[model samples]
Target: MDEAGLIERTKNPATRESLRRDLEGMGIGAGDVVLVHCSLRSLGWVSGGPVAVIQALLDAVGIAGTIAMPAHSAGLTDPANWGQPPVPPAWIEIIRSSMPAYEPATTPTSNMGAVAEIFRTWPKARRSAHPATSMTAWGRQEDEITARHDLGDPLGPTSPSGALYRSNAKILLIGVGFNRCTALHLAEHIRWPDRPSVREGAPILVDGERQWVEFEVPQIMDDDEFLPVGDAALASGVAISGNVALAPCIIAGMPQLVDFAVDHWRAAKHPATPR
Candidate 1:
């Protein structure tokens, strides 16, 4: 919606303080680690836009807490998989050879939205090393959460998803639905350990030098595929729903959510098996 429409719907602008209150009401509290996915527009007109939204999250989490967001650089992926605006087959090799290496300090997030893009550059934020599926985090546990990101298992046990799961973090969805949840990808990995594999390449720093590297990773599924599992979570009360400003929101424990998705998908895959 346009700014004018957002302003009209918002009634009162969402300032950092107000947003923090809403977040706390939704169960975000001090010392809690959270993986957030948000759309600034979905919150209606904010007093400080994405900045305010992020600050409020920080305020709710406090100094003892941590906040993390997907800083995925999908553009760094193999050009051969480019479908939104596919490049000519002949140009793929040229693009691969010339593409700039993924630099966590400068690489911009693709389609992750304004809030995440801002969080990626937030002061003291630590980003994972994965060239494509890196996650950025801030606050107390930032280092521990972003320390290791396995190239072959970008969302699996060695990635930030695993760290967050181990930490029992919360997944906060603002102005977005289950389809935007990245934590669910971890469930996919668990449910289909032998899922199909695909070759992916990207320019990344190796021994402090830029080089094009290739690796085999489990084929990533479309985000929409998580919708059914997410819906099921809400239906089963695994996730709590509320609102921040005019935007709909959901908060759930990351481990619970992932475990639920694994079971949900398993049941779907094996209809006769009791959940």
Candidate 2:
């Protein structure tokens, strides 16, 4: 929103302290592992913008805690799959050939919002090696969380989401929804082990040389497909709802939510089958 509109809607400028208090109220605390999906605009006007929000998260979690955010470079995907304002057919080859290799320190996130863009560059933050679906993490356990990102299983058992699940991390939706939750993709992988695969390509460094590589990954449902599961999560008391700043927020145990979604999807897929 415009600056004037944000100021008018926000009762007070959201500062680091206030944001930290709000986060703590939502049950985030020291040594907690949180996977955050946020929209800065939804938080209203802030004193320091994304910087303040990131600091507040750090303050809430303390040095013992760990924080992670999806740093996906979606634009690096094969241009052949581009849909939103798809490039001309003739330009596809040129686009793919010229696209820069994904570098953990230099590549920018696409459509991941301002908070994540800044968080990826935060000091001491470590990012996964996946060319298209890498995740960036900071604080304690950062290395463990971002250590093993497989090209063919970007959101599967070996990716950052898997690490978060293994660590019993909390999925924090700040001014966002479950559709933006990367954790749900893990559920999809678990529930559809035999799901069809899609061939995807990205530019990556191989032995210090840039090359476009192709790999097979399980096909995933669209973001909107997760909405029903999210609604069920809230209705079934799996997700705790609250507010941070002027934006609505929700926090849930990553494992609980993923398990709930798996069951929810299973029921829909096999309504007549006995559990």
Candidate 3:
């Protein structure tokens, strides 16, 4: 939104300390492994924008805690599926063949927002190696959280999502919803009766040459059905609700969400659901 629109809607200016105070009050504490999805626009006018938000999150979790965010660089993926101003049909192949190799230090997050884009570049941050759907982390557990990102199952049991689940992590959504949760993708990967996979490719450096690599990942059609589960979680109080700075927030155990969602999905007999 434009500056004027932002000011008109978000009248308060939140600070790092204020944000930290709010987050801690909501139950995040020292040594927690938390995945965050925030919207700066929703936070109103922050004193330092994303920088302040990051500082608050780090402070809320303490030195021993870990913080993560989706760092997906989707532009590196197959241009054939592109939308939101997709490339011309004639230029798809040419662009895909020449796109720059995914570099952890240089690539930017597409559609995740300013907070994530800035957090991934923090001095102590470490990002997963997945070219198209990487996750970035900062803090004591950064290394473990970002390690071994499987190229094929970007959001499955082998990627950062799995790592977080195995470690009993938490997810904190600030002015966002389950549709962007990502942890739900892990639940989808463990289909009871098995599921199909989708083929995709991304540019990566191999043997000192940048090449487009093709692979099939578990087919995760959509999150259109995520609302019911999310609503249940919130209404049942399993997913805690509160405020971070000025924006509404939701916090929940990653495993609990996945388990709940898995049961809901399987019982629904909607084979097309989840991962």
Ranking by lDDT: 2, 1, 3
| Clashes by residue pair, model 3 | 188-275
Q: In model 1, what lDDT does residue 195 have?
A: 76
> How much is 95 displaced in model 1, in angstroms?
0.5
Q: Judged by lDDT against the true structure, how good is candidate 1? A: 0.90
Off by over 4 Å in 1: 269-275
Q: Which structure among the candidates has the greatest lDDT?
A: 2
List model 3 lDDT by residue over 146-176, tens digit each.
9898788798888999889987889999998
Q: Model 1: how far is 37 from its true place, Å?
A: 0.1
Residue-level lDDT of model 1, residues 1-275, one tens digit each, is 78888887877888999999999999999999999999999988899899999999999999999999999999998999888999999999999999999999999999999999999999889999898999999999999899999889899988899999999999999989988999988988888788788888889999998898999989766887777788889999999899988889999999999999888877775421111
Q: Candidate 1: worst 10 consecutive residues by lDDT?
A: 266-275
Residue 211 error, candidate 2, Å: 0.7
lDDT of 3: 0.85
Best-to-worst TM-score order: 2, 1, 3
Ranked by lDDT, the better of candidates 1 and 2 is 2
Query: What is the RMSD, in Å, between candidate 3 and the native fold over all Cα?
Result: 1.8
Span of 10 residues, lowest total lDDT, candidate 2: 266-275
Q: Kindly list the per-residue Cα lDDT of model 2 for residues 35-145, writing each as its tens digit.
A: 999999999999999999999999989999999999999998888887897999999899889999999999999999999999999999999999889999999999999
